[model samples]
Target: MTPSRELWVVLETLHDVTYFTPEARAANESAGLRGFWRGYVATRAAPLGAAGLGLVTAVFHNFAPSFLARSLPSVWEKVSPERALAARLEGAVAALRAHLPEPPARANELLRRAMDGLCWDGRPLGAANAVLPWPDEPTAALWHAATALREHRGDGHVAVLVSEGVSGLEAHVLRDAADGSRELIMPNRGWTDEQWTDAERNLWARGLLDGGGLTDEGNRLREHIEHRTDALATYDLTEAEFAELDGQLRPAARVLVPGAVPHPNPVGTPRP
Candidate 1:
């Protein structure tokens, strides 16, 4: 099949590789992003803030909005930029150490080069620019590289969603159906039953969904999103580099592929 263009494996692998790096979790909590918000919201103070919910959500995908809603806004109250970048970097560095402990000598170089290749002019649209002013660290640099690339794809994704006429929540609903999973994003994402019903009606009326499920067209559209996302994500890399990256990244991902940790597959990356 000349490898899949959807690159779903590569996409999930990269996202999972970064997110599941055990130390990243520890770093986030110790730094107070997770602990401050989830552990004790009252303790979150003025100095610890972020850009906004949308920026946070786009970069930090796979998190439930309700969970994000709790900590993000409180943290985003004042918007201290450097600290925000460091908080995310901490976990990624930890994961890199835990995973790529041996020196590729040029791993950071590879990541940084790719990061430099990203186009980040999307101020109103993407999350990468939020930390544009910050300097890069080696292992942490990998995370920033991935974050920038991922957010670029994300910005393009929102454009695609709008182009397809799929509303935000409706896109989520359609994804779940197209992927054959029925889990709602979390009741805390600020959607009501009526709103959801209305989304369903719109999808059904347009024949994208049918009989309480995604129709063939729905699956096609969802697949289109997935493929387009992968294409955008890998846009900066050559085929050889991407193949090498996919191989290099799969090991860290494999560590967490099964029942490997406390939350078990928290990154939600499937095995290749």
Candidate 2:
């Protein structure tokens, strides 16, 4: 199996591993136990046509155009169901929220933890993109600070991280300052040392930043626990329910599997 596309994992709710093509599903059926399990998971879950398509669009909008050009078309061919989900991320998030059987408390915590992880991981579209009270203010300040640092000295560290991927907040700041340029390594964004300090301090204060990094510690916590919590909360899957799911679920199994074909799982799937 080839290395699976990141988009496929993100777009898990759309289709089964064979991309749900008649031929693929048939191949999956022939794969015996593995295919049976895959089909079982897909059949048990509800379809997410609109939501899946909406998510694809959201990804295209958020990612760099060139990157999307290389990735999206291929992903469309492999997992076309997800194309529609692109238009529905926001609405899908809402609908999934309502339909999920988890308790309100768990839902909130899971979301927070997930966002925190994104912030800490320093990737574009991570927790930093999450909406808070003030929008333009913090981001603008951070951008100014980063730019100043870049011009004054050359802290390509931040630039590298942003290029490698920083929180969506970082991307937005870079974009705003660079006038829509996606060149994260460029020193085109603007800011001062003080402003950068302020932004870092703000994130630190928010429990989303620490140890000189942007992501919160909570985000990297074990997915099993988070998934269990979410399953318990939204899906009304209790601890036992989670336990059952855990038994059947493989955590990054494909990564460890030899000869596993690289492709997206069905939509609504979480990273495992």
Candidate 3:
């Protein structure tokens, strides 16, 4: 399929997911979806051409500070398959880099390192061990937090720690309002300290934290998360290929924009 058509299909897929994922639609509600979407179409108009950017632009119109943080990874989950997620993510990087007049290869290299740290040698749900009530939630939550950190600071370990507010994320999720605290969203239930601790330790081991804050590896991971998010947003898919591409891009796409179903809690909520 042509690049223009691919972008149109991607937009449609994003719209379907947006409506399908209630949280995603609700989040867009606050952002004035229609107006925000118009801006993106206007900006990417040249690349979008006759078909325009379509739903992809509307779904991702807001472009808020934390928008991509929670969206890309989730989107990837819906689009890609378990086995090919990593390679698809690499494809996203390639597509985005091509779009840039002078791409930063160093940054891309750093992104791969970050991805390695998250994917557990390229395995799906390879992040921190299962700690939340639901089994599948931790990966997405952890990724969202990591994405936030990467966007705040451009993959600099020190910058990630200082600006990202590691403790704050835990506390925010847990509803404790304390720094250095972590909470696992219980989907339908509530929070649990046991699960939080496990997540904390796992994140620490994965270099999401250190004695002071985010470790060097954590910073690298954050860089990869941010880069991937941008790539997904910049990437496109054709109408016919959307379903086919979805299976391959699931993991990284979701990593790029986490807009999936009721993500399970890794700590305590009863599993279905």
Best by lDDT: 1
Candidate 1, residues 1-272, lDDT tens digits: the string is 12333333443444444344456556556655554344222121211234456655553433445656776566654334455445555555666566556424444465556656656564232343434543455555554554555556666667667668777778767866655433435353455667678888898898999886888888899888776655555445677775666666556545544423223232334465
User: What is candidate 2's lDDT per residue for 26-113, written digit by digit as tens?
Assistant: 4333432134322332221112221232343342223223322333334333333332222222222322223232222222332233
- How far in Å is the alpha carbon of 52 misplaced in model 2? 14
Ranking by lDDT: 1, 3, 2
Better of 1 and 2 by TM-score: 1
Ranking by TM-score: 1, 2, 3
The prediction achieving the highest TM-score against the true structure is 1
Cα deviation at 136, candidate 2, in Å, is 49
Please give the RMSD to the true structure for each candidate, in Å. Answer: 5.0, 18.6, 19.2
Residues 151-173 of candidate 3 have per-residue lDDT tens digits of 22222222223344443234233
TM-score per model over all chains = 0.71, 0.26, 0.23
Clash count (model 3, backbone only)? 47
lDDT preference between candidates 1 and 3, better one:
1
In model 1, where do residues sit more than 4 Å from their true spots? 1-22, 34-49, 52-69, 77-79, 103-107, 123-137, 187-194, 234-236, 259-268
User: Which of 1 and 3 is the better model by TM-score?
Assistant: 1
The C-alpha lDDT values of all candidates are 0.53, 0.30, 0.32
